[model samples]
Target: MAAGQKLYPRATVKKIVKAHSKCNVSKNVDVMIFLDYVLFMQTLVKEAAIDSKQAGERGISAKSIQKVAPDALSKFKG
Candidate 1:
């Protein structure tokens, strides 16, 4: 990924926020949410990769992600 490139589209993030939020979402809030989501996904993938390696797997698998998801979610939960 290039520096400053967005992994999630701004419009999509705004739409998601609008759907879930009762009030209007500001640009800053949208950016923050996008960053938080990216961070969470990155952490989740990294953990899954480690778990797969520990299990002697060649790549991260669905099972590894499932096993790590709960812990990851809890850690990132607000």
Candidate 2:
């Protein structure tokens, strides 16, 4: 999918996180850190056509992404 398609859903979540606080994180755990970051997870949420579990195994938590994307978060059945 397109990169914008990958990034849009989590836009609000990203904004929320940036507004909250600054964090000091290391690049050694970049993949883990990036996925766990709310903004990044939101990006995954946009790709709902893909299975979320697979994303998590790759370090992107679909469940976490569902939590941050405003639209997904609100309509989430689980």
The lDDT per prediction is 0.90, 0.50
Worst 10-residue lDDT window, candidate 2: 24-33
Tens digits of lDDT, candidate 1, 1-78: 999997768888788878887678887787787679899999999999999999999999999999999999998888
* Each model's Cα RMSD: 3.9, 12.5
1-78: candidate 2 lDDT, tens digit per residue: 866565344455444555664653343343444545665445545554355554545544656455446654444323
TM-score for each model: 0.71, 0.21
C-alpha lDDT of residue 67 in model 1 = 99
Q: Which residues of candidate 2, in runs, are more than 4 Å off?
A: 1-8, 22-34, 37-78
Reference-based lDDT, residue 66, model 2? 58
Residue pairs in candidate 1 whose N, alpha carbon or C atoms collide under 3 angstroms: none
Which of the numbered candidates is closest to the native, going by highest lDDT?
A: 1
Per TM-score, the best of the predicted structures is 1
The C-alpha local distance difference test score for the whole of candidate 1 amounts to 0.90
